[model samples]
Target: MSEKPVVRSSILPIPKSIGLVWLNIALALILAAIGLGVGFAQSGLAAQQVILYTVLMAATVFVLLNYVAVVFEARAEARAVASEEDQEAESSRLRQLWADNRVLAIAMATLLVLYLILTAAIPEFRSIKNLIGFLVLELILLFAFKISGYFAAGRSAFIGLIVLFALIVISAFSIEGFLSGPNIKAILLFAAFLGIASVGQTMVALLGGLDLSIPFVIGSSNIALLFLITLGVPSYVAFGFILVLGGIVGFLNGVMSYRLQGQALIVTLGTGFAVAGFTQIMTSIGSQFAGNVFGTVPGWLSNLAAMNGRFFGIPFPPTIFIWLAIAVILIVGLKTTTWGRNLYALGGNRRSARLIGISEFKYWVGCYVISGVFAALAGSLLLGWSGGAFIGVGDPYLFTTLAAVVIGGTSLLGGNGGYGFTVIGVLVLQVLTSFLLGIGLEYEWQQFIFGLLILPMVALYGRSPHIRATV
Candidate 1:
């Protein structure tokens, strides 16, 4: 008797680009139809119009999310050595888990329907401004995701770039007015703040030094500047004073690290803790506003924070340009200037640098000073943006700044990174955080996500040639 052989069927669905492309195309058409319908009618939010908008948002979310899922799924597979069955099992679980994308899509759709029918919908929902914003945003994401497939991993920043775009696309669908001019600008502004702080971090990383006290320095500088302003110092002068204060802190860090030699981490950490404790004391005793200290910082300072002005058609503060300028200066100065070249060499190998007459000690002081000054500058800018600073204002930035530098592909051992990489990392973290918020994740959840993410990124770089954590 001949027994029929049983064939094992794979459980996981394979990655199919054609299907994702079709899904994106269909979503695009739906969004277009919704925009056209809204465009054709200049009037109220009727039941039919609400349904259309709701569907548009949901479909947009579905496509954007699925696009990201497929990309990640493909990445996982490429990185995997698992058996076909295991891949299938994981794929199946992902399918089940992410099906909530559709469910949540429907849920948001339903919520929109009910909200529009019951309450008065805001006029902003029907505006062409929103339509154009969304269209432009989606188009960019779709294109970026498409382009990302062409690049090799670790060879470029394309992965982080597209991942950011996909997240923003989903945010546009999930968070109302997320794609609008104001929200996007707000994200950029925050990114700029991180960029400012990252400048110091980048330099320190370049010199194979770490500044753990950055958070407190930034927070304290912010409060100190406000304290100065209230004491009748000019805003510009107050700002300068904080920068000087930051330099002092950085100088202290350098002196300690230099004296101890290879103890930059411990020195910076101790200083950071000390500064943080003092800042807390100051916050408790300083002028109060709504249960928190409100420095009487001047108006124009706030204007920079608020990005009150714009060039041509662009929004104000122009923080991106500021970040770009900082990066450019760092690159060129490091390339063209003797100090910059020495700094890189010093970072690359201290013994060799000293042996070659690079003046390692002087470079160390300058590097730390630069780091401190930038930290203070970042703090002051943030204070202006937020109306004032609090005790923990710079706390989150400590980790975020390090994560940004590392993610930007800057080597932990130093002498092998750029501001461009830091900027990309800054944008990635900012966009990810923003998207998580848009999806209604709480603060704790956001922190959890950062923790989960930062480890992997560090681990990825930690194995590279320049990683010398013990050193």
Candidate 2:
């Protein structure tokens, strides 16, 4: 008798595409409900309550429906792939389509509809300028998501952008009460400086190195420049000297890191201490020099502590130009140069980079050098902004730069980031600090709140499945 043919079966769990989609929708709804409750409790417009509630409910339903539709379609395709005898062809086609444009199209459509409704229903948001600003911001965010592959990879970035947009809108309105023209200009200038300084730090961190010396470098340079200015050095000459000094310090950090071939953190920290000591010595020397001159220097240099100056009705103070220049140079260097690509390669995988004949030492030095230059630039900007720098001009930036770089989504483990993210990260941090100041929070409280806000974003950005797999 012929033996009965045996049949075997394998179990494979279907991807939870539907489940994920529903979960996101549910979370969004919960948030919407909470927002509605808060608005109802706080809003004093009795006449407009019905309209407000109706608009809120409509928005909730619309978002929920849109999410459900997209998810259902994706799930259906997934199911079809699972059931197919030759799954490869069907799955590949679906993935290709998904990757090309379906998700982006859906997202853009949703945002457009939401904006239209918000503008129509909320008179305050209907102003042409504000509407245009909103559109521009959304487009930028969309482009960011597209380039980063965040839209395709997972839902986290999509959610993040949405949350960020909400925060930006709130800030645009709420900031008016607290920010005078001068105050706004000051905040923007500071943010720009912080942005440029953090670029170098971010590049360093991207290469699996950290420079603790940045703050000291900046502080020393600023103090030196202040001393020069007090000695009647022309503004142009003093500025040129400050830039050179910053470059020298940066080059030194690079040399030290390259020669040592050890933990960058410890190396930079030691350098930082030495630099700090030098700064103190320089400050003392400057004070003595001024004393000996018997008050020949202009008193205005001492009295004008605030960097409060106007530029073309913008109130940009002197420091803004320095910050803008630094930003421009960094952006160009990183985005359009061979050195930038090599730096990324070295950071991503040093061994592979070596195999490919990339000079690890040279790129590593370059990273530190860049960091140094930015640090010095930051110092100079600080001095100019303050009208004259003090010994501690660079103190706050040490931690702030690190936080900004990490929060901007630059991998602390090295590789995988850009200056644009750094810019946003700086903005986010500055905005948080400004918000705290606006709310009249004490300095300590502001620091605490800022930390609280940043830590989550950093942790989220740093944790990665591929890195975990490697470990």
Candidate 3:
């Protein structure tokens, strides 16, 4: 047979590094223009703040997107070539330069523009106080971003030290006695509480399951604790009981999910409804029984309920203790324990896990149990923070927790996430919420904005494009 000559096809040329850089610059300009246009339409100090925030966020997103695109594009090109050594070298050079320079350059440019706008809009902004405030704000961002990057780049142990340093710096810069120490402490306490709550959801997500029941579970537990408190139970005893109850609920979820062999979403949703109903009933019971046991309730319990008590010269609520305890326990459990390893294994590949002699059912049960305990702890904290549980106490947490977990970079699809990401995710979401409120957005608008923020993160990190491609 006559041999035919082989012909290589090269119709679509791979995009060059310069081309990608130009594209990124173009995107940044478009983002900047849109942000300024929005600000101009709004017409006030609020508008300027919004514009600055928008520019920062847009620029950050642009950098991240471009980084991902460059990495993936290089990989794709490498796969097509006879030899990828030169291509990889070129890609690496481009990536290193961009990472080292682009983000900072954009940040500096945006800050300069914001400074001009602030000076123009508010003449008072030129004062020393305003300048100091801007410097403080910049420092906070620098610390936060540096810490995030440090841990995200795989340096885990340094995270705590970085956070501690950041906190110390923030406290040092604070207007001493400007706000009562107790009030400040309470705010920090609540922030920690919400952060831990988000961590629970993140853990579940890491295992490749979404527990929609988290809200209801939390609400029910909170309501239960409130009922116990109203019935004259000591706070510590109530806390213990709530924790046990949460564990039981989690066990049930694990059992049901494993036995039914159903979708985690469907299973959790069903449980959530059931738990929510139970919570409403519990709330009604607590409200009715409050007066009957007022005399029996201990003075210490009542004092603890207020969340303004002083502990070791630094005023903090009991909820803060709960948050700290939960954070420590969960973080350690996930990182060090065999059960945690199993959850990750199961999440990554259930079939492979089984082949390795890992019990999918047992680990699944354990995950639910852990989730339940954490949710319960969150519920108890909510009760203490609120002075008493109210209806829908857990409702907001459901979405927020999921958002925090997803935002923190925990994959929604099973595996490839951690508690650290959840913590950062929680902080980011809370700050964003606070910022939105400060800007005077309506409640509905806040929810809408959060959803918008959360969707992108979830879409980017949660789904596994590589896995799908391989499949």
Candidate 4:
């Protein structure tokens, strides 16, 4: 009889990468040098010295762990000689493990490299707080990813929330006053604006279209609201008029883009430019600047979005609750309503949806109309927050709206994401911006970092087939 075949355990041996080990060592050495330099530059108080030495020790322990893991992996590989079939099977399993973990590994390496580079190159980054914050943040992310492996169904979504939690922790720990009442209120207030602004972009993306005109709509509506108010229109009345105008703009965008098929981006962008120019021209007829539209913001409107504004005697702003309400409504509406189902059907497969008697035209137009109304609402609310308006006021929304929607895991291809995800995305962006600002990063670096962060999400989602293809 043939000798019995040897069997391996279910868990695959950890794969080894010598390059990663070397990277860990290099980073450790750099970190040690930084620690020494800081010590020599200023031997501070007892507590400060303790923190510095603790950080160095943590780095040493981390490097030692990596080396120990690599050594174990090496020994395992050396002792694992077997038949050709077993060897091939083990190789396949190792490859699978590598594929599954390569992204996390690369992310960790990239972050560590950035940590070292930024700390060395940027004067602002050389602080002990920043060094500890970086380490803590990296560990949080690693823990989150490791825990995410247990719940495979919604791992990506869960990872986002975990990351948000991690950021909150890191920010609270590292920033002097990040969790202070004023700062918290500020973050929530701005998040409310972005969340509201993102509403239209989210809806449009769900329908497989983009409204580049959102920023323009935002700017124009912001100006228009103030202009109307200055013309003696009651604030509420002006608000209503502006919303209607936004809806009309949305209607035109939907109609024209629908007719043009693949030119939604171009059409909406052109429409936005035209609307912005027209609004600027109209508002500037008797004014000095295209962007300046000054008017007294109403008390009610101010209470709606101001950071100091309260909700039923609570310290929080009303805008936060309003956003929460809107998010809940949209989330439920998208998941349960007939219109929502039709919207998904239309987006997931237009041809099939038509066969099922769904009107693509109606849904498409309706989505843009909703988008326009939200953009207008955001602008109006922002007026209260800012107490004035400018033509470029809505400019930042151009990138952020899209980024929030995409970062929330909404497929740009449509029919796969919801307002719930967008809410998380909004929070993430707000917190991240606050964190960056706290750390003294410049605007350009923040934008650069944002772009880099978005690429990974795009690549991750792109790997999956679209909803239509899956169907």
Evaluated with TM-score, which candidate comes out highest?
4
Where's the lowest-lDDT run of ten residues in candidate 3?
1-10
**Tens digit of per-residue lDDT, candidate 1, span 1-471:** 222222222333323566765666677666666665665565556757766776777666565656565666656555365667766876898898766344333433443443343223434345554455444544553454345446534423664565466566656665678887777787888898998898888888888888888888888877778776776888888788779889989999999998997899999999978876666576557444421456566777776676674544566675556666887888688878988888777777788788988887788888889889999988888887788666568888988999898877777677777677788889889987887576565687568656755553343232235523334
- Please give the TM-score that candidate 4 achieves against the real structure: 0.86
Better of 1 and 2 by lDDT: 1
Greater TM-score among 1 and 2 belongs to: 1
Question: Per-residue lDDT tens digits of candidate 3, residues 1-471?
Answer: 212223222332323577776777788778667556545554444765866776886778577656665566766655566346665766799899877655444554555556556555543344333344446645654554455454544432233333334334443343343235654564566567677667656766766777787777787876677677767777688878888888888888888878877577888889888877766664566357421112233344434434665455555565566566766877788779987888777777778889999998777777788788878877766665565555567778877787777666667777666887676666556545554454455787667656754543343221334222343
Cα distance off (Å), candidate 2, residue 191: 0.5
lDDT of each: 0.70, 0.64, 0.63, 0.81
Q: Measure candidate 1: CA RMSD.
A: 11.1
The reply for model 1, stretches above 4 Å from the true place, is 1-158, 169-176, 277-292, 307-315, 318-320, 457-464, 467-471
Question: TM-score per candidate, in order?
Answer: 0.64, 0.62, 0.60, 0.86
> On residues 1-471, what C-alpha lDDT tens digit does candidate 4 reach at each position?
223333333333222576766666666766566576655554454656756785766576555657566666664564465567766766898899989877777777767776776776778767666777777877877776678777555565776787788789888987889999899889888998999999988888988999999999999998899999889999899999999999999999999999999899999999999999999999999778767887788898888888788789997789899998999999999989998888888778889999989989988898899889999999888888888888888999999999898877787888878888888888988998999899889988888766765554444332346788878
What value does the lDDT take at residue 275 in candidate 2?
77
Clash pairs, candidate 2, are 206-414
**What stretches of model 3 exceed 4 Å from their correct place?**
1-187, 232-234, 282-307, 456-471
Estimate the TM-score for candidate 2: 0.62
Q: What's every prediction's RMSD, in angstroms?
A: 11.1, 11.0, 11.5, 5.0
Ranked by TM-score, top first: 4, 1, 2, 3
